[model samples]
Target: MKIDVEHVTKIYKDTKALDDVSFTLSEPKIYGLLGRNGAGKTTFMEILSGHILASDGEVLIDGENPFDNQRLTESICLIKEGDNFKKDLKIKNVLRIYAYFYPTWDQELADELIREYNLNPNAKVKALSKGMASALGIIVGLASKAPITIFDEPYIGLDAAARKTFYDILLEEYQAEQRTIIFSTHLIDEVSLMFEEVLILQDGKLVMQQQADALRDNAYAVSGATKDVETFIEDKEVIQSKQLAGMMTAYVYGNMEQAKSAGLTAEGIPIQELMIYLTENKGA
Candidate 1:
């Protein structure tokens, strides 16, 4: 499904959660929705999933609105960070309920995941540990087989090993059947490799949206003598720079080859670092 966000905006009292953000997700690829705290990542996901209405503009999935639209809602599954189910519901009941909501729900897969995660279906949501609850959410998200699967910080309280297990299963599921997956997480370094495209929000604004590989290929950290580095980056788009002890390193969005040819030591910037540089308060 093609997701089209056209000038979408959201407001909460005096704060603008989203400010005229526009982007087109035209392919079924894994997208990393990245931003720091309160950067409107959650707000954007809510608007996209129809949990909340946009204050202005619109979000269209295959040319139709998602809000209160049953057909689209069935095709969209959003697994949030926490509190995904009612406290009174048992694990089995939660799965059963979601199975009814999502026509494409796979009971077999859900069962397998529950066992794999070592979750007891008889346990109530209130009794499960934070990690266990997150595991339940992951199972629902993967088994839903929704055309658009949005996971917002879905693995809270999970240990590194458990998180890896979820990531492995997620990749396997995506490979088995391609669908749009929008993953929002704070552990950027851990999941950055899975992102085909990255969209970054900064202070309620769309700061960067680009192909992950292209971003890695073009963005570089060039280091050399302060004067030489300064001269080389003068005409380039510098995301950030630091000078120390006569040496300067400029995080630049430009040709790596050109930087290398200019006698500067250039290295590709990791997506996580790139995001930090792009979103940091440069004026400071």
Candidate 2:
């Protein structure tokens, strides 16, 4: 599903959650929507999923507005961190409710996930553990088969092994049938490789949006003598830099080959480090 977010903004009382952010996701690829707390990641996801209306601007999925549009909404599925299903309902009943809502729901996949997660369908949502609850949410998201699937920190209490399982299953599902997956998670190192593109929001504004491979292939940390490093990066797009004693280390978003040829020790910057450098309060 193609998404066009044009100057989208959301205000809550006195605070602006999203500030005229605009971007276009025009392919069926897994995108990593990242930011620290209060960066408007959840707000953007809510608007995209049709749960809420934007205060200004619009969120378009395949050229159609998402808010209050049942046809558009049925094609989108968003699974948040917690409190997804009703506490009084059993797992099976919850699945039934979701099946009714989603025309493309796959019961077989849901049943398989229930067995894999070792979840008893008869158990009520109130009785399940935190990890179990997260697993149920994951099952619903994967089985919904929506063209657009958004996961906002979907693994809250799952262990490392369980989270790994979810990642593996998600990739397998994506490979079998390509779909647009917007994954918002703090576990950057764990899933950064899965992201084709990355969007970063900071302080209610869109700060960065770039291809994952481009960031990995182009962003570099070059360190050497202060004067030499400074001269080398004088014309480069420096994301961040540090100078200590007679040595300097500069994180740049250009030309790894050029840095290497300049005799500076160049290493690729990890996505997590890049995001931190880009979104951190520079004045602080």
What is the per-residue lDDT of model 1 for residues 230-258, given as tens digits with 9 covering 90 to 100?
Answer: 99988999888999999999998889999
RMSD of each: 1.0, 1.1
- For 1-284, candidate 2 gives per-residue lDDT tens digits of 78999999999999999999999999999999999999999999999999999999999988999989999989999999999999999999999999999998999999999999999999999999999999999999999999999999999999999999999999999999999999999999999999999999998899899999999999989999999999998898888889999999999988898988999899999899888998889921
Clashes of 1: 0
| Model 1 weakest lDDT span, ten residues long | 275-284
Q: What is the C-alpha local distance difference test score of candidate 2?
A: 0.94
TM-score of each: 0.98, 0.98
lDDT of each: 0.94, 0.94
